[model samples]
Target chain A: MELTNYVVLATILFTIGATTVLLRRNAIIVFMGVELMLNATNLALVTFARIHGDLTGQVLAFFVMVVAAAEVVVGLAIIVSIFRTRRSASVDDVNLMKS
Target chain B: MTDSFVAPTIDWIYLVPILVVLGTGVVGVLVEAFVPARARRTVQVTLALLATAASFATIVLLWRDPAVQGDPATGGTYGVRVLGGSMVIDPFGLAVQGVVVLLAFLAILVIADRTSTGQDAFAPTAAAVPGSPYEDLARRKGIEQTEVYPLVLFAVGGMMIFPATGNLLVMFVALEVLSLPLYVLSAMARRRRLLSQEASFKYFLLGAFASALFVFGVALVYGYAGTVDLAAVFQVLAGGGTPFADMPGLVLTGVLLILAGLLFKVGAAPFHAWTPDVYQGAPTPITGFMAACTKAAAFGALLRVLYVISLGMAQSDPAAQEDLFVALWVVALLTMVIGTAVGAVQTDVKRLLAYSSIAHAGFILVGIIGFSQASLRATVFYLLVYGLATVGSFAVVTLVRETAPAPERALVDATAGVVAPGGESASAPSAPTGGDPVGDDPSPAVPDAGVVLGEATHLAQWAGLGRRSPWLAGAFSLFLLSMAGIPLTAGFIAKFSAFGAAIAGPDTQGGGSTWVLAVVGVLASAVAVFFYVRIIVLMYFTAPAEDAEGVGVTVVRSRGPAAISIAVCAALVLVLGVFPSPVLELAAEAVKFVP
Candidate 1:
């Protein structure tokens, strides 16, 4: 399997994730989109590490995973906090401020 | 051959300032766990202040020592590269770190003040649902949120590192460290809990996307250069020590992607949709902190990219340089126009200030894009001045409140046949508190120990504030004038230096495009003055309408930490404005970036 092909697949996954974030109304779903985007980057990093025969990118991937986990914790805390108040996890409903 | 690995050289002294802040933050967390709830706020406040001050002192020590300057071995023109080349402590980074610590200290003063309401800006317990019995009960108990103090220390620590890290990976980590606490902090407002949460959510979701984009850009850049260390990447991009094709496409794409993340952080346009909402919704003090320190950190990192990294690109490929310049120019132009044009019409003071911050971001970008030594010095000076003014102004914002009358007051006024200027009734109920489903309830029956007043965010509520509280009004006006770049103010020096850099930069770039930036900057600041002056006008010129006294707005008079912070900031702004030469010389000396 060519390492380059993995990069292509990762790119596709990243697009889907970004699109999901843009399209989804549910805050949880949008959060999942963010997770997917991060994972896609992880995939790309790993593939680049393999292609280059260097462990730096692979180490970076681990860091990304840890960061993503942290993001999940904070993101869920915020989403849950808001959800408890509004009784919904929809982004559109969170509109008390405007221009 | 048997593998033998040796430990990398460690420079403990170079790491001291960062470790001090982070260590204090950890200690604060432990303090949270061990200390009695009643004693927590005091201890946390002391710990945070000492840590930030200690870090600042350490930075001064590091700055004075010639042995620790860059690399003694090769006469490197940067600070000590420590943590196995993950961080640097050069003069530039140190200056920025100093600014961060100073501003953090001031911000902490504002954050810690409790005299006005015997409650800080943060919620007593962030986990409690707004308006829920749990929240009301916590409020009744006067449960102090000492946890925010630790979070602030951690955020400040992250900020200290964000602009100083030598590697992209560490930069990303520092970015999150700085950002996460802020997201949590924004949600912890004592009043308008729902708006606070919404702001946090929006900041989190959008900020996550920006982070993802940043890491993706990092991956691509790593792929292009085969390394993440900035110096090594610069070497590769500069065309002497690389193993990849010299195709500009890969590198340019990576640069743009990374810039997207950075630009988002600085609240530059196209990426600025979140700025107004987040700034308006966050607690005022935190908003001020975010407006000031975050931009300085982001711009510091940006300067490294442009001066150290992109300088290599420009030398190797003129076309790539032009592309980068043009991209930044468009973003800067849009930010200036959008910030001023939209700011002109905002009725909410916080939102209006938010727009003004975006405009200031544009002005800073003009300096950044100019890519000269003058620009660097101007940017650092501008950041310091801007941070002081911002933190001070927001302190004043927290003081002004619109009176929330009991529901019966509206009925009494209705029966009395009274009308006032900007007519309804002089006793017209405060602007419909939106989404506050319990609006008719007047004020919460939460039995807290201090005065409960609604945030007077409406511009009309500020009428005759100058008459009611002259000193507060005067201080706020000074900050506004400084922000508007008026003469005899700190903002004037910052804007003049920034525009001076922009004008000087066109000669090196071989195009007249940068001159356009200078003009836009000047015009934008001019437009900005109208809105800023409008606030002063509303405060001073408009008399309080009949029966509106104490009903429309009241300035909370408290000789608390917030007042002290405001006084110090105002003094600093005036001092710096009048005697800028000493600071300018220092900035000039600290202008060098380590490649």
Candidate 2:
């Protein structure tokens, strides 16, 4: 059972997104990283479902997108409010949450 | 794609509790937007109570229906395949739903009392227009703000669905619905001192950051597993730690990082730096609710991920899973030690309790460490016990009656409303406890009665507490004892179950742990005893603080509903402690979901 190359590429892209989230300071960039990761996941789900000849993976991916959309809207609203309140969005600059 | 075209069918019945909560949140937001200030209290509170009780009743009725002929969900562990085989329902999800039902009910009680009592006094207006009366003034009290309650319930409902969801995407949605309101509400305390606002702000900012992390993690796992259905992932991972066999190493890191983000929401160590500040800064009641309910919800989801996924990881090599378990055990260990030791040294009552909660998380982690298919009973039982105690402890703290406002920067949440500016709110006449800069006192031996006399002493001093608040005191003691793990208390039974499970080892068909960790946990608990006893000492041994430095100490009186919440939690703690079989049996019953 040979694994597909598409799966491997999608995973590498996902890793980049995750790393950006860990290392990036800019909130939007971090958010973009998250988006990239999510897109990578959708690709993997669709590709695997194609390989396995099962539709479950494809359906789950669709739901993931729907959720991603909701998260983005809410995330934007939260970031907007934090900016209004704290006047900044850099993960480190938002010191109001620290212990 | 064609499968999605069929439009994944959702079992509406399975989502009833979630819908009810969402409806409640919508109602709360509506009231916050449109209701007259004075009338907002009644509307938001009644709506919240009704929603919780109704959902609770629905859950109860689920059990009452004839098992054979009743609805498929009511009869067996009810499940609706929202996305065909991508997700399914098991009793594990249902058990968490039950925990949510209880948590929602308890949160309403705490929220209602705090809001009602603080009418005309909410968070102080920090950074108010300068050259104002507040320039030299400290934090102000808050006005009633029950609107946050229903919104919180909505989130709770979402969180409840989170662990139950078969799909990662749905789980993510549930996580957001549960968390967003909390981030907002943490900032809404009445004593809008800087600390309160800071608490909420930090909670929001960090919480948002964590959510992003979790989202990315999910995407990575989706990439590796190619589906979000937990069961399907189990099938994939069942081959062992090598579940992601063909995927690039990057995908595995994504899964672990996403887990880190989820763990943050649960306030597990390393990610837990935010716990103490937020707990200390938020209004005591809100702190309690968050500590208890939200933590439970987080753990519920965490358990599902580990047991459902990692169990397969464990099968790869029991020893490898053991190593993974060991890694988590270290995190939990640090959390327990840090939380307990720091909590023990706090001069401020709230700060002390916050640390104690941190320590408790470690104990819960102890149960979590044993998360094999067998660790299910231990984990679920421990959560039930630990969750109740956490709620109970917070209930006591909430009832203690705050004396001062947070720093001005703390009340910054109102600035974000963007709709109506929070108007001026009158302060509470005077706090029974001292929370401000105190002048030198003549009484040299006088204990910080506020710190010592925390449990029922505040109620005793200002609001007819000792006699009128006898019931509240009893309930408070029950919770206090539970935290103490006293025999015949729920806390005792819960702690026992977790430790027992942890010690039971991986094959025990319950939560198991290394004896070394469990013993360390026990020793750490002895340190916890010192603090729990401190509260009890204040309640029983210490005299109430009198007009020390002209700061009068009037006890707060508990209202009927508020008192009832305490009474019920206390009674159950004792009931479970006295006769552990039934509850423990139920915990054992819930373990089937583990494998």
Candidate 3:
């Protein structure tokens, strides 16, 4: 039951993130969505570790969290800078690097 | 998080390079966050340089350690299996990584120089002369470009980890490690305005999707194999007792999905639609770095996944594997054909090379299809040749960006910054053109060039570069030649080795596949020559368009790191082209830990 609940929660968070990333206009909001997905992955990883009775999974999860944290710090900084320069965070509003 | 599990002992000696890079990156960020804006550039460049040098030292140490020699066990093939079976240390990983790091640094140098025009090379002045608009231009375009180095190091750390990762989880981490920074960096180009941001967003969305696909594939493969250990998968296939036919569909699906994800990273044909736009829009340095390092790492993982984990199954069930190979062959050929055809017509240098890289990916995959762990030696060899040449090409591209005087700053301030009394400024001071006894005027009567910045087109701006900066032009020419695979250059040697290795197929210990694909590879490469030379002809032979700025003349001069990076990269390409054995031998032995 515990395992199932953890997975369900992870799924819910991931879905929410996906929806926000797809639907939101704010670039920062999309970034938040990305963060949500990353966090969901972390939770899922820990849940798997509990199920497996192994600490390796947990260690791996720790690294994931570290990486995710770094990413957010950098991503948020970049987004903020872009916001200041371009003055709008909407995806539709920004179209510079498009291929 | 768990006390019960015996923690794997940390090997700082092996991991020292990574730590050094991360440490430097963090320091660089702090430097940015805390330092006054004027002094930040010095902190950024110095921190980046020191970190790179330290990590490079660690890499040298890691490369020399006898323990990592030969084919050490990979943490296992399922990519999620821990420790031994997923990632194997070998010359291939080390060689590719070195290429990645070197390429990353070159890009840092390029962005630094190109974006810092007119301002003090390192530090930015806080205020501008009244009515002159010099300060305003700097704020809008030059100096303030301190983020380049930190982002470069961060990307290097990711590239280092990308290929060295021993497990699927680590691989995913490595992918994002490099990618997240890239997504942000993409939006920061100084030219092409909105298109740069668009590249970042598109790359982010696609990259995220690919990551999702990759993870799902890993889960499926784990589910089917009942083990994430690559060795176990190999053992199951090679040891011969397990019945693989029972779940052929699952295995096939898992492998394909995994391939798709890796392919996305490499910008292989079906997934390569974004290359042209992104390369054209973002800062040239970043594009060069992404094209070389990211492609190398992605291919590194893909090579390991397909060749190492899936080979056993392929050998066991030759039909399934051969069918898969055939499907891939079609894609490779199509990519080659399309890339060559498209590249030939491109007027933009960045877009042309973008297509060229796409074609090169196709050629490299052909090398992959011809490779097997049994002939693993050749695979690594081809990767080296390909990796070096690709980075070398991008380095040249960075050098070609035109340098313009900073749109901000009084010539007097710039002169003071450069030819100051003692050269004791906290950063790289601008060339003090202030000694120009002739052009020194403090009058707004000239009308601020900043406010009238109506059409400072890159191409039009660079029309008379030969007359203005012949040294930059000459260096760019060598780079283009090297890129074109001309004789007496590293590109030629690199391409020669790849083609030779591919045709020799697998291990060339007397008996190999005789490289039937060499002819096709050669022909495709010949097709590529049309465009490589076309760009050269245009650059060296054609005159800048009349009145310039016909939407094509966009030449932005690089001042600091970008200049140094181009010089270094160009030197390396020429040097390596003439003398290729030492690096090759080092790469040959980078896998001692793979037993």
Ranking by TM-score: 1, 2, 3
Model 3 over residues B170-264: C-alpha lDDT tens digits?
67777887888888777665433335555666677667656655654554454345444555555655554433335655566657767887888
Candidate number of the best TM-score: 1
Q: Tens digits of per-residue lDDT for model 3 on A8-97?
A: 687688679778877988877887777777677667656655655556556665766776676666556655544543445676655432
Ranking by lDDT: 1, 2, 3
Off by over 4 Å in 3: A1-99, B1-5, B34-36, B70-88, B114-116, B119-145, B239-246, B372-468, B507-517, B549-561, B590-595
lDDT of 1 at B165: 81
Q: For candidate 1, what is the lDDT?
A: 0.81
- Write candidate 2's Cα lDDT for A43-88 as tens digits: 7777767766668668767766876686676566555544444445
TM-score (C-alpha) between model 2 and the true structure: 0.77
If you assessed candidate 3 against the hidden native complex, which CAPRI class would it receive? incorrect
User: For residues B9-49, could you state the per-residue lDDT of candidate 1 as single tens digits?
Assistant: 78889878889999999999999899998788789999998
- The candidate scoring highest on lDDT is 1
What tier of docking accuracy does candidate 1 attain? medium
lDDT for each candidate structure? 0.81, 0.61, 0.59
Writing each residue's lDDT as its tens digit, candidate 2 over B1-595 gives 5555555566666567667877777878878889887688788878888887887676554433333123555345433454463333455666666777786677567667732233322333322321133422423333445556676777777767777676666777777777776766665554433345556655654675576567656755665665666776676665523345555443445556667777787777888878877886666666767777777777777777776666656544455455556667888889888888877776655566667777777888886675444456666666666666666656655554423122222221222111111211211122212222111101111233231112222222323233434555556666767877777776776777677656776663443436667788899888898877776666665566554332334234456555566666777777878887886776665554522
